[model samples]
Target: MSLDFAKLPKAVASRLAKLGIRQPFDLVLHLPLRYEDETHLYTIADAPMGVPVMVEGTVEHADITFRPRRQLVARISDGSSELFVRLLHFYPNQQQQLAEGKRVRLLGEIRRGFFGEEMVHPKVRSVGSETPLAEALTPIYPTVNGLAQPPLRKLVNQALNHCVLDDTLPEVLRHDLGLMPFDAAVRLLHQPTPDTAQRALSERTHAAWLRLKFDELLAQQLSMRLAYRRRREQTAPSLRATGLLAQQLLASLPFGLTGAQTKVLAEIRHDLASTHPMQRLLQGDVGAGKTIVAALAALDAIEAGHQAALMAPTEILAEQHYKKLSQWLAPLGIEVVWLAGSLKPAAKAAAIARVESGEAWLAVGTHALFQESVSFARLGLAIVDEQHRFGVHQRLALRGKGGSPHQLMMSATPIPRTLAMSFYADLDVSVIDELPPGRTPIKTRLVNDARREEMVEQVRKVCSEGRQVYWVCPLIEESEALELQTAIDTHVALSESLPEYRVGLVHGRLKPAEKAEVMAAFARNEVQVLVATTVIEVGVDVPNATLMVIEHAERMGLAQLHQLRGRVGRGALESSCILLYSAPLGEVAKQRLKVIFETTDGFLIAREDLRIRGPGEFLGARQSGVPMLRFADLERDTVLLEQARDVAGTLLDHHPAVVEAHLDRWLSGREELLKA
Candidate 1:
């Protein structure tokens, strides 16, 4: 038998297409979400509470009533006890179907209701007393709107019976790894025995699920390994780290490098000295001194007579890097050039000319660094800060500007262990885990909006003690205009309330000069209170600022909250961050607030964030550029990931035939252009 999705009904084909299922293989991989138990019937009293179960009883009566709102209410009796059925919205025929003396089957959760024991909006149908129960549990698959479950199940069944599912992993290998055969795993997952543990299946921890996840992870690892091998095959300049420039700058700094920073810099230096372009991800928690490490990396490239460039996601962050790097490198007689969208034409022209002439040893800017007009004379290294905020193509474009420059991607947002293992498997990752000494941990507090006045008073008190404060407004949904308005309103409110202190406003709408002025004043302690938007979430540093009051903290993610909190604790005056949230928080918002309030560990917060939000949203722009895992849960399938990673290397080396077939089946067209 053969399955042709294109020849199927247009509606069915269109719905399947909506789910990225274009072929028989896709349908086969589209597995069940959960199973509905219909093989056994439970009486009203015997049916478990808060779980789906099959129940059959005779309808004693059915009527439409207005207990407060109009609804169809019915009572079902199993000869001993009764259960109420409420349908807030129902058709007239549904009432007739459930009229008195009718025997019907109900499949839904049972719980105590407003009136009595009830199952609201359950699957309802009339049935004869002699009707037999199902022989197996019904498989409920994931579907989109306008596609019903019955049709989806029929499509999956067709695909399963007709689609050819060959085992990609060798039988000997599967046995060695304690994995089930591919066909058996698929069949068991689609049609499990009644004795199978529901919890294991639901949580994807069953043996059958293990095979699927392992295969998926193995495909991803194989793809990444191929990418890594391809990069190694290409040639790049070996920027030997003579340390002539790097050492001189390190000694010039007033502060000493942390041990973690030293270790990461050594790893990067080793990579830069290699023949192949270094594709490494540098992850450090906020304020871990990544800038200095990046500076040193750039210095190595310059010392080896190769130019380097650094790209940031925002102008503010780019300027911050330009200033810091200039302060460090200018004294060493290595000139630095700044290129940005905000630069005047003559200034931008001069920067471009310097970069083109190789007079500027290192260039720093926002996305403008990758613009076609900006050219690099001998680009050897490219560093991207806040790498996640930019899409995969943007990073690729930057890398393309150089003749295969050694790329260093930096992120202050800590990547969780599972993510680093799975998504970033191809790159050599270096982490700066420890902070420098004398920095006090920021105390995180969750306060309600009603206490806004008290927080105002707290800000007043903190500033009166000769420290500064940052009061941030929530991100607006539709309107940048509205977001700017909110910032302006907050700035006005703070200034009026605290008349004795100098309050300054800065937002994305502000001119660069104005924004820089406000920031410099705050750093100088002239502006006691700074009100701004999330623009400051990345690059602002004020040691004197000891208090941070974020409005509507529930509206932000764990990473943003962590970054915002980091802005305050840079000083040693016992900093604190107050997260002010409004009422009626959603489940995700509550979780974000709780995670931010309880722990300051970025890695722990990242793990919780991944759990709260899945990998697609968590990976941000990388989702479009990488083949993401759809079936595997990173947090739960770490062991399988480890096994697959080992197997990927094995298959690539010994079973090359098996590698082609496996990659063809899983990642055929989904391979990302993940150059960086």
Candidate 2:
């Protein structure tokens, strides 16, 4: 029978709905955040001090007091000892419930009050002759503002009592995996026996967490694998990599491709030559020549008499790709068109026409490229840069433009192996593990605010040597809310401190045209020192800008700091990155700075980033169409992920019916994400 939220009380249902609990199954899966041991009740005098304890007593006196502030005080006695109950905020119902001679149960940490031992804002419930108390550890769930723990816990217990969940995993597989049964795992997770180790259950060290984590991991893997199978079933144009355009573009380049780049390009070539659609994720560190590899891949599609589109998240990045690709392909007799949201009507229309008429073999633009008005004549490949910034639906939309054209996604933010296995399981991944030759390594150092004069002198000297500098501020403008330095204030300070050099400012708040103008001036060396935010992190590639001073660098993440540092060291000159931090650096901030100063490897930094800031913060909540993982910790449960992948493959090969059952049980409503 289907469960209904309407059957619940009106107020209770509203609060539960806010917590995303609409059905009984939702309640069944609503696990407790923690467990409080409220099994043993003691008199107020016998309760353990400074420890969470349960006490039972009868109210002797209750009234409102105003010595320090508005307060409600209730003196309760257990016939042998007296205790005080303090309530800062109380309802009239609670006041009546705590009237004289009324028995009550209280749970909170015991502390020595001014009068004696007491509990401030303790959880209270009026006891009656028929009321039965729970004798086990009480489960504490995440609750809404208007909801309390008692009702929520009772609802979950009620759901559990009526739930008849079937075991989803195959019998043999479950036995081999040594996993607990589905119902048993849920029951134990919610209500362990009094003898169960409180520490183990509360810290998720018990075997139950492993079983649930495996279950969740297996479901995710099966979904992604099924999605991969479905995508391959869809036919796509098999564009041969003839190397006509790719070879020409390579020959025009000043340097040779690194071995890693060559290997990844060969893989892409193999994928393109196949009849099946190519869904590959190309991961490269900053300055590892990912764009060049993408450009080469696009050229193969163009040479095969098909159009190719490269989409970026921002217009600046789109324009950067446009300029670079145009320079490489225009000389080889290939038409390159740029389409952006800010383009003039005439220019956009012409660009659209060229794309539709197959006059332009290569098109580079932002999200505007995927608009309904724009259509490709015969698109063979679609390249998306900074793939994480774009959603899975956006990728599907872009690929739909060409009837499932070969999709190649490039990301400068290198994903750790755990994330790659779980999140990018659907797509084939290729890592460019090598940087091009002659790319200088950036020297990273941390400087405190007291060394401001020394850092300023360093910037002035770098600018005097005919090179530029980047002074990055964390915030755009001065705000009373945050103490971080702002670009506006920094620009003014830098311009005044170094009057001989040109200082230009750029931030996200600037108009596109204005921002583009400032970036262009910086690129042209008109601005010797560009004071900006992270707007220049991904796109701006100025060889003359060799020095970068990031103020309040500790405020940024490891991945972002690495990207900003990558802005320098593109040229042959030795580059330096000074991280100006505030005084009294925190442990995490100090570790971040040390990691950047120690190693320049993007993959190492990415792994460290994942370790420091879990998967949720590292990969955003809406990274893809797939639902955010709630049970499995990607950092700790990678072994489970690997096992799940193997089990999923086996099930698909040998036990297809069970696979469907597993997916239906765990991911019934999320089937569309796999297809996406």
Identify the leading candidate in terms of lDDT.
1
Model 2 TM-score, 2 decimals: 0.96
Q: Could you tell me which 10 consecutive residues in candidate 2 have the lowest summed lDDT? A: 1-10
TM-scores, one per candidate: 0.89, 0.96
State how far residue 449 of model 1 sits from its true place (Å).
4.7
- Alpha carbon lDDT of residue 543, candidate 2? 87
What RMSD does model 1 have? 3.6
In model 2, the Cα lDDT at residue 422 comes to: 88
Candidate 2 RMSD to the correct structure: 2.0
Q: Which stretches of candidate 2 lie over 4 Å from their true place?
A: 6-18, 129-131, 161-163
- Candidate 1: give the clashing pairs: none
Candidates' RMSD to native: 3.6, 2.0
- State the lDDT of candidate 2 residue by residue for 45-150, as single tens digits: 7788888888888999999998788888999988778889999899999899889889999999888887677889998988875577676778888889989888
* lDDT (tens digit, per residue) of candidate 1 on 1-676: 6677668889878888898898888888988988988888998888889988879999998888887899999999998688999999898889888899999999999999887889999999799989988766788888999999888877788888997787998989999999989999998888887888989998888999999999999998998898898899988899996798888997898789999999999999999999998999999999998999999999999999999999998888898888889999999999999999888999999999999999999999999999999888999999999888888888989999987999999999898888887888889999999998878999989998888899999998997888889998864233654332277788888999999999998888888878888888887889999998999999888888999999878888888889889998886789999999888788889989988999999899988988888788888844437777878988778899999999999999999899989988887666657555
Q: In order, what lDDT does every prediction score?
A: 0.88, 0.87
